[model samples]
Target: MVTSKVKQIHDFGQSIWLDFIDRKIIFSGELKKLIEEDGLRGVTSNPAIFEKAISSSSDYDEDIAQLSKSDKTNEEIFFSIAVEDIKLACDLLAPVYNEEGVVGADGYVSLEVSPFLALDTQATIKQARELWRQVGKENVMIKIPGTESGLIAFETAISEGINVNVTLLFSLDRYKAVAEAYISGLEKRAADGLPVDHISSVASFFLSRIDILVDPFLDQKGLGDLRGQVAIASAKTAYQIYKRMFSTDRWKKLAEKGAVPQRLLWASTSSKDPAFKDTRYIEALIGPDTVNTIPMETLQAFRDHGDPASRLEEDIDGAAGILERIKVAGIDMDAVATQLEEEGIDKFSKPFQQLLDAIERQK
Candidate 1:
């Protein structure tokens, strides 16, 4: 039986995707069980995730050893292994992907491009296309950071008919740019007489990281009450943006031609502060046309005690007010967002390099 709490999120039009992926879960049938019993809608993997999965377990040793014998570089070997896992996962979720024949509805897995190419538009575009071809699955979304350069790659990828997951979004302005890019991509496709219905994308707005960064500043400014609130407030405001952006006449034309709006995906959702409840992000952000990709621990926590509700649209003005107060507190949000983007790029790049180094040792 599906755990009513986790499964119940679907009733509010929200989908829960697991934030972690590895060979153990895929091979042990754990991923399948999550889909069947917990209503898992998708899977998302990052360089850090692959680093942990490959380094911490012997599950990938055989593939590594086999690929090593072919004189492939460590990075090449890594993608080969990662692609195989993504392909297997896509197969497992094929039912959900095919559910009702709605292309952008549910059942999507995300594989991120090299974070090293985050600042290089052309390189990122090349790699995204290559990864898309390598995975060779309709349900797979190639993850690209929402850097300014990444926006170009994202738009180019979508125009070429590849699915995208725009990660590392922290600013409302950048989020608007991402949505504009998505629309532009679809418009280009439609103008070129290509199929727009098959193109799918998600703008992933990170959650806990926002509060984690702003809380210390809040404490320094003696505004401690707002410690854990900024992220949710930001997310609620983003939803309002989603509503406005998609309701425009421009979006309606694409919709008539079968272009689905790129849904907002909530990433980095696990609570960073121990004082907060385990499912703090999940319970509060449940609403239509959104996804919350959570870690396994958070998933278990939510399944046990989650109280589902349509709370995302609640407190619209209150959400705006929290953001205003944070601004008035003199914490430069745009600068904070800029810092987080740089740090986020570094965070992924280091692990990606470490993962490659580990693979080199194996080779």
Candidate 2:
């Protein structure tokens, strides 16, 4: 029997996705069980997750050995392995996909374009298309950072009918830009007489990292009590923006053309501050047409003691108040968002390069 809380979360219209992926989970049928038991609807991955998966496991040994023997570069080998795992995941979720139309509870796996290409619009688009072809799965989403150049690449990628997972967004402005890009892409596809219904996308707005970064600043400024507030406030405001943008006439036209709204996905949701409640991010951000991709720890935390009430809807007034208080406390949110964007890029680039280096060492 599904827990009432979990069912309530689904009833509230939010999708829970696992943020981490590993061969053990996939091969052991654990991922399939999550779908069957926990109502898990999707999966997401990044370089850091991939690095840990490849470096810490012997499960990929045979594949790595075979690729090493083929004289392929480490990067090439990495993509090959990642794509293989994603294909397996896609297959595992295929039944769910068929049951619920294209918008169902499964068959979604995200593969990121190189973090090194985050700033190269043209190159990012090129690589995104290439990765799409390489993965060869309809349920796969090409993950792109929500950088300026990434925004351009996002527009082009969606125009070509590539499903996207726009990652690393930390601000309302960035979210709006991503939504616009999705709309533009769908508009172009419709104009070209392409089927827009098959294309889907999600804008990933990172949650816990905001508190991890801003809470320190708030503490140093004598506001430590505000430790867990910024992230939720930020997400609440982002949802407001999403509502506004998708309700506009422009988006309605694209909607008429069968364009799906780029749903808001919460990432980096694992609690970074041990002092905070483990399900703080997950519980606070629940709403309709949204997704929370939880790390294993967070997922377990929610399963254990989470109160999945309609808290996201219950505290709209307070959520707005918190943001007002944050600004009044002299926090430059835009600056912090920009810093997070740079740091977000750096975070992924380092892990991605490390994954490549680890593959090279294996070779």
Candidate 3:
């Protein structure tokens, strides 16, 4: 039998995780097929994904109606439905998590905290803990945005042994800050003699959105050749940063205490420009100790015709020059990242409210 193309990505040391989750896929054995046949090792969900799934499908209607009749609020009802899905998914992927294989390392399922609380550190912390308790699964990763406030919440969550997926990150500077927070969390745990082995986290560095913002600036600046390039360049630079930080004595000390280096996960990876290859981000960003979470269409495109290789570290100098040229062309990367973070939060927050309202209408 010919091996599916997605499984070949594993040979290069990068994981291809599904950037979606829904009740039908979980119960219909679709998720199982992907896990066993297509080499899908993980799942990621957010308010946007859940909103589209819950609002568009009858799969969740009965649960919504039953929860609506109870005293639970719309938000509670939504969580009740979401947590059950996550619980079931976690159980199905338990072996992948325990196998602890180097490539298909963690069988994680990500559930985001409320996007409304993106800036409210304390509320993010409280809700994350509560959600973790509700799900009650060893393999579930509570996703928090990599906002300024979220850095604190991440360290706190990881210090408490809760696995976190720090989402919505965009800039190299901010990615550094996230790595710092992860290290700080592990150090704190080790300082307290806490068992740091089970704690896991991933810094989700967004890919395609960088070009969505920066490419236009380049085109307007008469740098047509530079169009559709910023995202991969920035991600390559982020990987270099990952290597530098995780190789340090600080990380080594934590590793001695059983802490896993928080891996770099590439998020928002689908190629937005129809003119570009569908799997550009996935192919360009492949490397060891990292993940690329992709939506279904992009995942299928890769399996159909993707060429996987270890290209992430191939052009260290060239990647640096690309960012430098962006700077020379007057592109403000910090501003772009900041704007994307705010928009990313709103993107999820709006749909989340819509999801709650949709669930309420089921009554």
Candidate maximizing lDDT = 1
Ranking by lDDT: 1, 3, 2
Q: How many clashing pairs in candidate 3? A: 0
Candidate 3 — worst ten consecutive residues by lDDT sum? 96-105
How well does each candidate superpose onto the true structure, as a TM-score? 0.98, 0.96, 0.98
lDDT of 3 by residue, 1-363 (tens): 888889889888888889999988989999999999888889999999999999889998888878888999889899899999999898888877888344226799999999989999999999999999999988999999999999999999999999999999999999999999999988898889899888888899998888888888898988889888888889999999999999998889988877788899999989989989999999998999898899999999999999988999988999999999888988899999999998899899999999988886787
Estimate every model's Cα lDDT from 0 to 1: 0.93, 0.86, 0.90
Candidate achieving higher lDDT, 1 or 3: 1
RMSD of each: 1.0, 1.6, 1.2
Cα lDDT tens digits for candidate 2, 1-363 = 556455468778898888989899998999998888777878899999999999998888889889999978888899999999889888887776677555633457899998999899999999999999998988899999999999999999999989999999998888889998999999889999988988889999998888888987887777777778988887888888889899999888888867779899989988888888888888888888888888887887788889886566666777888878778889888998999999999999999999898888877
User: Can you write out model 1's per-residue Cα lDDT over 1-363, one digit (the tens) per residue?
Assistant: 355688889889999999999988998999999999889999999999999999999998889999999988888899999999999999999899888856568888999999999999999999999999999999999999999999999999999999999999999999999999999999999999988987888999998888998999999998898889998999999999999999999999999998999999999988889999989999889999899999999999988998899899999999999999988989898998999999999999999999999988987
Candidate 1: residue 244 lDDT (0-100): 98
